[model samples]
Target: MTELGYAQAPAVAAREGVPRPCLGCGAPMAVTADAQLHADATLTCGFCGRSETMPAQAAAQDRYLRLRLMQVRRAREGMEAPLKTYEMMRASGVFALIVFGAQGGWMLWGAFTTADKGSAVFGMLGAAGMMGVILANFGMMRAFRKLIKPLQQARPPAAPGLAARCRSCGGDLPPVRSTHATCAFCGANNFLDNAAAHDVNALLTAEQQDYKVRASGGKPGDNTIYQRPAHAFYVWGAAGAAVTFVVGVVLVLVLV
Candidate 1:
């Protein structure tokens, strides 16, 4: 993940001073970050448009490895963000609901037991306000289904492949996607290459590119499907809070 940035601006372009040949046409594949700071790449022929995604590990050397890492990291974070938020919401909502139920019940009992008519009415209104808090919190938790299911689906299904073997000593390589994974057994920088492996790495690399485009700041590039709105959780939270407030106020007004 870290090594991808240590290479260059368009780091994954060269290896041993020979341009990384396009697998399709043997022409040099030039990698770039355009005006949108997106990693521009295609493992395809310029003339024939024959493209294929190769594993970053098998494809290029030190230079291009960095670019691949950048895309992978960005995509991973983007895809995982919704899942994290959903977990937080689910945990917090349950805790709050437990407390809310106890408090609301106590308030309603106070309203019921009060002798004075005016005081009893105000107490009932206060109980309603408490109920508002519970209901709003509950609704927000339910609303999270819109994001939760999508996030769950978006998670890349894991495809277990053979661990990349160290090129120098045949030791098992744990970090399959990296260009600089040092083998514990032999201390050799070895990883899985595209040729000797399944297309899983290439599929991940392509997905990461799309995620990186969406994760990128500023106007989205051509590849971006939908820009992730900043502070989405906060916006939804504020909306829920506003609902609680409005419901409480309306209940009090109607009672008085």
Candidate 2:
């Protein structure tokens, strides 16, 4: 669980270069400085064609965006830490179970073979208890995974640059405000290289391209046809292609 709090909204200032995840498509949406100055600004997602109007200086709106972004970043970081622990525990558990099985099997075999019925019963009970404990551990881990299942599924692929992601925690690095940018998700400080520092816009461009590829199924470009109001164009294009095929067939038949 992650919580985010914001201070009182200040006078409208030029706040640009902040990317918020879209509610409709989860793609990154840029909040322009225009949004800050104006009474209302419409944010349209480039990926899914979802548009929503946001008030420029409303206190509640200001708080909501900041809170939502903070929650997203914190939730991502929270799930990542536990997931790493779960992986390590799973590997150790597998090795522990293997050793337990081997030793328990031998102990039971020896007790049963010799004329020691009491020892055999004790060995059997111990083995059952150990197995029960191992199963319980696995069950708990399974539940933990299930708890964070939605986060895992919604996790976006890392953007294609060192500057685009945090060095420590693999979360998306926030825009560089200075020489070094502190990760919102993880507290690690990432120093931007000279090239990256000079070309901060490149990071946003890379992320937008990545989003286009995802939304367009590996074809990255203007994908408005997939969005509403443009679906008719796609239909018309298909119909035109069919008509062209029929026209070519008729031409070939007459010429032959």
Candidate 2 wrong stretches, greater than 4 Å: 1-80, 155-256
Cα deviation of 54, candidate 1, in Å: 20
How much does candidate 1 score in TM-score? 0.34
Instruction: For candidate 1, write residues 1-256 as lDDT tens digits.
Output: 2232322334333342356567667776654432222333345557656665445554445334545445544564454444454455546655665565566556545644653344444444444544544555555455544433223222122346545544333334564454346543323333344424446667457556756766886444332211222234445555655565566546645653
Candidate 2 per-residue lDDT, tens place, 1-256, comes to 3233323222121243455679988997643323332234456678998876656454346445544444555655553543444555556656766765676566667765773555554454445434543654545454544443322221222433544555444555566566556665444445545334344465456557766877888854332221322232234434543454455334434432
TM-score of 2: 0.31
* Worst lDDT 10-window in candidate 2: 5-14
If candidate 2 were superposed on the true structure by all CA atoms, what would the RMSD be?
23.7
